[model samples]
Target chain A: MTQTIIWTVAILTVLGLLLALILFWVARRFRVEEDPRIDEVEKAMPGANCGGCGFAGCRAFADAAVKAPNLDNQYCPVGGDEVMQKVASILGLTVEKKAPQVAVVRCNGSCTARPRTNEYDGVRSCRVKAALYSGDTACSYGCVGCGDCVEACRFGALSMDPETGLPVVDEAKCTACGACAKACPKHIIELRNKGPRGMREFVSCVNRDKGPVARKACANACIGCGLCARTCQHGAITVTDNVSYIDFTKCKLCRECEAVCPSGAIHGVNFPKELDKEAVKKRIADRKAKAAAEAKKEVPNG
Target chain B: MGKLTFSMGGIHPHDSKFARERAIEQLPLPPVVYVSMAQHLGAPAKPVVAVGDRVKVGQVIAEPGGFISAFIHSPASGTVKSVAPRKDLAGNPVVHVEIAVEGDEWEPSIDRSKQLVTAIPDDKAAILDRIKACGIVGLGGATFPTHVKLSPPPGKVAECLIINGSECEPYLTSDYRIMLESPKEIVVGAAIMQKVLGGCRCVIGIEENKPEAIRSMRAAVAELGYPGIAVQTLKKRYPQGGEKQLIDAVMRRQVGSGGLPIDVGAVVQNVGTALAVYDAVQKNMPLITNVLTVTGDRIPGNLQHNYRFRIGVPLSFVVEQAGGIPDTAAKIVSGGPMMGKAVSNLDATTVKGTSAVLYLSEAATRRRPETACIRCGHCADSCPMGLEPFLLNRLYKAADLEALEKHAAQDCIECGCCLYSCPAGVPLLDNIRQAKGQVMGVIRARAAAAKAAAEAAKK
Candidate 1:
């Protein structure tokens, strides 16, 4: 019995040693050489895996950062400039700083402004509703108000406002990951520079119908009268398809376009409220006086 | 009798058909009608008439927008009040042609006589064109254009034409009324469709609960001496009228995942659609009217009505005619309770596929609180498509798109059986429905990508 036990133990030990040696040889033979800097770059990454940098994840971005000739087109939007700079230093490359962006809902057609023409009773998804037909409102271009963006946002930056029937973005929590923008079926969400002091101006209406039709559908719809575009001194605003767009890069926040907008579609948020009210009132008075003078001149001609 | 049923999973729900015995009544024309342009599944028909254009009944008011679209005809003779966006059955905004009723004068080409024209034309193309011209669609709730369904893709030969007389949905008796009242017309319609399908054998499948319909249809088939046409009685089951389920019950063939009924040499048409086809081919009449049942358990006895209403009539008007919205009604469904959509806005009007306006009381529609799943597999047993709803629900919660596709999420038919059968009151169908949409979108994107790659390779 003692001799059999000794033989069994020796044979088992030999098999274990042989397998370990083979495993070691295979590990070395098929070893893939990877850059040591990739691990450091990944460690510096925010690890959100939000895919805001057009990469699958932080590890994927790190791999590409180590292999790419230069970090020209590669930048993490979530991390802004700091993470990209760290990655660039680790990779011995350089990356240009890009302006931090936040998603902004481009529609201002509240329930009170744009009355619901019908009710949507199908799947409670904005994408599904958008695919089915126009929304409950007559303005087909407005938000469907189904909270699909809120559901898609991993950072909890969006929530549907019950009163306005629109999504509200929390700038503090928003990483400008572009998930909400991509999830928007109507293309109603846009990523723009957060602006100084979070002050931003944009045309809040997406309706492209003619003036009369647009006005009939939503009270705050852009009529494409070109008044705001003409009023912008810096040429920051342009009207196309009966809708106006504000170029944030060129906008001076002068509030001229907002004052001149007849439908109140051009909106400026986080600006000085008292100054805005005063300027708006003054603009209205000036418009009324001009119209009266023109009418008087036409009457004399008649 | 050993009744025929689909071999897969199904459920037995209470057939709350309170208005089954009531005969169909003719509803008076409303003051104004809102005829939606998108009553069918495809692209909305483009408006052919302006706001102030005078339109006669049976006149084409909107033209088909695409190959799969159907034409929209004026259901009433009136002056067009407005052509603008209006609310549909589910309260979604859809472009509608609003007309103020002036008179009920129909187009001159329509034959208004009460004679039953049993002789089907030999020209198949002419029959299909006439069906399309009349805007005939599957009235069994899926408003697929009949013309497109009749003409299957090449290499697919329809060996059997299944007539869905199985009004299996609880509280829906429009098809039953059609079968009992217009048996001759239905038989002739089936014969016409069989002729269109190259002399394919026709089978009219009705649920066993609808004995009167089966008797009447069989008698009609015998009287007409229609060759290659027969009547079948199916077991009373929820979703038995489902196109796939019905095909399985009758043909004993399972339609493969993501495949149509024609893939198995069969074409199924609703009995109402067949009746519409008869009118379209023989009488040269358009589908301007349909039968709808308006019933509620809490409603007064006299208030439950089965009306043959004209298309484009406001549902509110019909409800008011029945007894003004019942105080007990907590939810109003556009179709039967099992598959119908909740009426979010009553201002929405009826369409070509409107079969019933069901009102469920608060007690009846109340949902039980969801609890932890016990792995009971009841949902799996109840799913008519043999899908594991509980597993799908879990995968959806995990947002595992890859696993969802592997499990064939797109095969879900959105039938409420899993939800109804779950002992834990889990919303299996709801979660699965959303996941199905996501999986289908992914599949479509992948297909498009592959197509593009193939094109590039060819170049």
Candidate 2:
């Protein structure tokens, strides 16, 4: 028992000493200068090195911050104001509190609005179909069922409603990364202010064709006829080349423009309380009535 | 045959060179031609001529807008129908000068004679000036001004000049036909490019697919007894014709990411550029016409009709001449399958950079449903630029801009190699491209921010 105990102790002593030496040498050899600022700057970072700021990652940003004088335009999309405050505190510099952005799909041409006019048998890819022709549906401005956008969204923010052949943005997962926007050839996706109540207003239709041509193509295309602009109390909308652009800065989320659109082309979102609920309900009813009238026109008289 | 090329990743799609051995034939003037001003890279050349102006063949219609831009010329003796906008393959409405071609006429200085001149020129400046004045650019679709290519930036010595005879893009045999028929002129052009590059040792690289071209070019190189001009046969691969790949294949040097061929002590010029140099210097002819290949799978007898049309010939009209779109053909692309873009508008015309009009069946273009990127490494295996496309694609998805920038996403040549080789059929470039743009914007913004900071510090 004595021999066994001594042997065990001796082996333990040697192993322990070797480990201690290794740790000591490793600590010395591979030790980075440990810029005290790196950790501070890192803590201040949003931790999502999603190259929106153009550096390699949070670590790289920290390195750049310590090396360079300021983080003027390096505001993190993920970190936003809170993280920027942390970073500014760490670096003892002033930071801009910029408005955060979220992605909004501009096209609302759902199944009822933009019905499929033809069937396609090839690849189920928006990119492929987009490359091949305008679309199987009569609405050239509408989403072609293939989910290039879904594939493009890294944050799992976009999911295609298989029935509607369109994408739905899950605001929680979305980072306003703009991947889907670039992936979409139709430019039907835009980034807008998330607004105070997680609500936002946007002209969902990106179709720039004239009012008449747009109506012919898609029932809900924004004709850029400037009706939305005239109706806005805050002058939030501008019409150029027959396309209505909502200036998010001036928009008050009143949903007034949605009421005045002849083609129901204007859209409002995240309204204050029950504001414009009646307008949307009436618009939906009128659209159903118009659809019924068209259906009736197609049917033979008894 | 020397070792197969040194490019990191490349694929061998079937080289349906339907027009491989087809003789170069002149395309008779169409009723109307729509020439786009924004043909080459860089800022689009501002139009110098307006609508309804009478233009002779080879007249300068547009001048270079910037250092990288190429000059535009009248394709044929014609009156400008309209200086209007026309849709391109990408559906971008580019400013186009529509020309209603009149009867065939030759430029005053252009030697209409089919005379072969073999005398090697001595003055590099004169040769380069002729090429520059003639507005001859790279003919293999890059359309980089030949003079600019010959004029390397100072302190960067070109060690070896690569004469790219690869003509590797499938279905386009304009270069191959040029090689087979006008072998001497081609040699003279390469020699001129070599001379203009300050007498760098020249190596004419050809893909082994064209054995006859190899044999003919090898014989010509030897017969001329040129000191440095050696014909090297490379393994057949698509995009072997790319400048970086061609440089790597010939010079055995990997071009640094975001670096050009000249950065590696080499200058790679395409075969068509060589011929254009010859025309500009030897014949004093301005660049107005190019031999375009009108071919597809259903094209009868593998019909390789090589027509010399002036830039801006409507692709729809060109397709009609080659017996219109086949009833079975579903998609029309501008260029080869690998690098080509689908033309949404058939009314779009052949620009200076327009190479081949590829017709892919619906079956050829359909994407298999995209599964999660299996990390197959096939994209890496095929990336000619040796980029980690899978990682880059993932980073792009996450919008991890910094990781993407560090990964050198800016170095991506956007050659569609990664997208083509992706087993998931994931639009790898579409994702990476967005990230790349964002990262670049960040870099630019950072640089500007740093400059401002420095300026403030100075103050």
TM-score of each: 0.88, 0.72
Those runs of model 2 whose alpha carbons end farther than 4 Å from true positions after fitting are A1-105, A108-204, A207-237, A246-264, A267-302, B1-4, B104-107, B117-123, B219-227, B302-304, B369-383, B388-391, B398-410, B414-459
Provide interface RMSD per model, one decimal: 5.3, 5.9
Error of 2 at A67 (Å): 22
Instruction: Residues B1-459, candidate 1: write the lDDT tens digits.
Output: 357999899988877778888899999999999999999989889999998899999999999999989999999998999998765665455789999999789899999898999878999999999999999989999999999999989999999999998888888888988898999999999999999889999999998998999999999999999899999989999889899999999999999989999999999999999999999999999999999999866777687889999999999998988777878887888888888987766778999999999888978787777889999999999899999999999999898999999999999998889998988888777778878999999999999999999999999
| lDDT tens digits, residue span A80-125, model 1 | 8999889988877888888888999999899999998755544577
lDDT string, candidate 2, B203-276, tens digits: 88888889999898888877877678888889998678888888878877888866788999998887778887
Per-candidate alpha-carbon RMSD to the true structure:
4.3, 9.6
Candidate 1 pairs with clashing backbones: A118-B91, A119-B91, A119-B92
lDDT of 2: 0.78
User: Could you list the chain B TM-scores for each candidate?
Assistant: 0.98, 0.94
